[model samples]
Target: MKLGFIGTGKITAAVVQGLCTSGIDGLSIAVSPRNEATSSFLAQHFSNVRRMHSNQQVLDHADIVCIAVRPDQAAHVLSQLRFREDHIVVSFVSFLTCHELVRAVAPARQSCRAIPLPSVIHHTCPIPVFPAIGPVMDLFSTIGQPVTVDNETQLHALWTLTGLISPFYDLLGSLSDWTVSHGVRPDTASQFTADLFQSLAHAARQSDPIAFDALAHHAATPNGMNEQAAHEILASGAHQAYRQACDRLVQRFPILDE
Candidate 1:
């Protein structure tokens, strides 16, 4: 199958690298020259990937097109390209609705919204794809865990959760810093914190039937350090503050899917 990407940014590079190394056969990729460095890097690194001279050229050569352009640039960029009636479009551009994309990529009857995290480079992230058409589903499934939601509202809510990634890394950094201050080497502390969180995440993923609250309870024995820290954090209202932030973000979403 031929896959083309209209923008060559980090997300695009990650998806391309994942797909190229995915062992999914008969896949060739066309990338736009919008970002020359990234496009050139992919074409040079992956034998099956090709760098196109233009965005229209990407659409012209591939059956399925993925748009990874910024939200602010989407309307302007899409206005210049033409899509075919048979083309299937998957947009990685946030804040752009399926309705808007359908109009922009008119005649390309099918389209979907997707949010892929940087972890997709490792082919292990949860890629939430709205509408979940078969061809797009297959693409996401190859690179990451494909999450199909009922509507765009649900998809947007999931995307909002992605905003927490930085906060998560910050938490890890804080832990690593504390360890370093307490005499551990910087690299040792960083590695320990990263591996610790990774193991916790792995355990959470493995515990499919377990609710997060239940998992937390299981890890926290009475008067134990985990319980003590959990109590203090709850008392500090940090979790409530995070929820409030998420509510504010959802309110700011431009797409009126509600």
Candidate 2:
């Protein structure tokens, strides 16, 4: 299979790295040269990876094309490229619905929208895709669990929750800084904070029919620290704030419109 990447940003870099390291033989990868450092690095490090001179060149060389351009640049950049009717286009552009992408890449009959987090490099994340396509889902499965959604609205909701990732890290950082303020070593504090969340997430993932409320009840003993903290956060409107933030983020996607 031949694959082409239009933007060599961090997500593209991570996906390329994962694909190269994945044990998928007889696969050729082509990357646009816009992000020279990343494109050059992937080309130099991977045997089957090639750095192409232009976006058009990348499209010309591959059977499947993955668009990873930023939202602002997606329309303008894609307008210049010519895609064949036989080529498959999988987009990672946030806020750009599949309808918009189809218009942008006309003649390309197969178009898919995918959301792949940075952890995809570790082959550990849920890759959500809209309007399920066999080849796109199969390709994403190599890097993460591919979840094919029936509608764009459901897919956009998953994409909206992804916006909370940064906030999650910031919350962890704040907890780590609290420990530091209480005299814990900086490195130790950071490591503990990260591991605490990682183990919690792992546990949640392993549980069958997992429920947030069930986990909360299991963790919070009577008058225990966990219960106290949960009460404090919830009573302080932190949980409500999180919901509001997610709702706002979802509004940015036009597909979610009523």
Most accurate candidate by TM-score: 1
Q: Model 1 residue 253 lDDT? A: 66
TM-score of each: 0.97, 0.96
What local lDDT does model 1 show for residue 27?
92
For candidate 2, give the lDDT: 0.92
Which run of 10 residues does model 1 get worst, by summed lDDT? 249-258
- The positional error of residue 104 in candidate 1, measured at the CA in angstroms, is 1.0
Which stretches of model 1 miss by more than 4 angstroms?
255-258
Candidate 2, position 57, lDDT:
95
lDDT of 2 by residue, 4-98 (tens): 99999999999998888778878999999979999999999998999999999999999999999899999999999999999999999998988
> What is the C-alpha local distance difference test score of each model?
0.92, 0.92
